[model samples]
Target: MPKIIYVDPDGTRHVVDAPDGTSLMQAAVANGVEGVLGECGGSAMCATCHVYVDPADGGRLPELGADEDEMLDSTASPRTTASRLSCQLTASEDLDGLVVRLPEEQI
Candidate 1:
């Protein structure tokens, strides 16, 4: 299992175990990490799981697919180069210590 750190807007952090092959949204939802609504259930159809990957780890993730790219524009927070939908992030040993920062709001 890989460990992912979800940092909320208030600067609080929730570290959770992310089983390999599961999406980041699934890991967060399963662990009850606050702020990651995942309303689309890891479908990449909603921006509710919007987060900013730590710049250091951004290059390690796969490029966003079309669905996630489109939905990111609809997030409550400002879109950024680091912005990504958790639904599109799969947990793997390569992402063992990934850190993602949650936006102030999601809708």
Candidate 2:
């Protein structure tokens, strides 16, 4: 399992063990982590699962896909280079200890 660290807007941290192949959004939603709504149920159509990958770990994440790139523009929060849809990020050994910061809002 990969350990994912989700940091809420107010700085609360929720650590979760995500099984291999599970989306980060799924892991967060399942573990009751605040700030990740996953409203689209792991689909890249919605930006509700937006998160900011820790810059230090950015290189470890998979490349951004077309669907996620398009939806990111619709996020309620401003997007940055580190912005990513958690639903598009799959858990794997390479992503162990991945840390992501939640935006102020996910609507």
Candidate 3:
């Protein structure tokens, strides 16, 4: 299993073990990580799983697909070049120590 380090707006961190092939949103939801809402159950329909991929590790992540790109545009928060929807991030060995920061609000 890979490990995910989720950082909240308050700078609190929660490290959770993410099973391979599952989406990051699923890992966060299963672990009850406070900042990730995962309201659409990993579907690209909702932007509730919005996250900011740490710049240091951004290049390691897969590129965002069209659906994820579109959904991110719907977020009320300002989007950055590192913006990503957790539902689109699949857990893998390459992402073993991936870290993502949650937006202050997800609605």
Candidate 4:
């Protein structure tokens, strides 16, 4: 299991053990981590699962795919270089300490 660290807008951190192959959004929603609504159920059609990979992760995450890049443009919160659609990244042993920060809101 990969230990994902989810930091909410107000700085609350929820450490979750995510199963391999599980999407970050799916794990967060299943764990009741606040700030990740995942309204589209891991689809890139909505920005509800928007999250920012901590820059400190240092390229541990794979580059975002086209669909993820496109939907992020619709996020309710301003997107930064770190912005990513949580559904796009699969958890695995290589990403054991991945940290993602949640925005104040999501559209």
Give residue 48's error in model 3 in angstroms: 0.3
User: Ten-residue segment with the worst summed lDDT in candidate 3?
Assistant: 34-43
Q: Judging by TM-score, tell me the better candidate of 1 and 4.
A: 1
In the range 7-104, model 2's lDDT, one tens digit per residue, is 98888999999999999999999999979999889878889999999777888988888889999999999999989999999999999998899999
Q: In model 1, where is the ten-residue run with the lowest total lDDT? A: 40-49
TM-score of each: 0.96, 0.96, 0.95, 0.95
Report residue 17 deviation for candidate 1 (angstroms): 0.4
CA shift of 89, model 4, Å: 0.8
Cα lDDT for residue 14, model 1? Answer: 95
lDDT of each: 0.91, 0.92, 0.89, 0.90
Colliding residue pairs in candidate 3:
none
Candidate 2 residue pairs that clash: none
Candidate 1 TM-score over all chains jointly: 0.96
Q: Tell me the tens digit of each residue's lDDT in model 4 across 1-107.
A: 89999998888999999999999999999999968988878879999999998787848888878898899999999999999989888999999988899998885
| Stretches of model 2 off by over 4 angstroms after superposition | none
Highest lDDT scorer: 2
- lDDT per residue (tens digit) for residues 6-99 in model 1: 9988889999999999999999999998799999788888899999997788888998899889999899999999999998999999999899
| Position 83, candidate 2: lDDT | 97
Q: Give model 3's clash tally.
A: 0
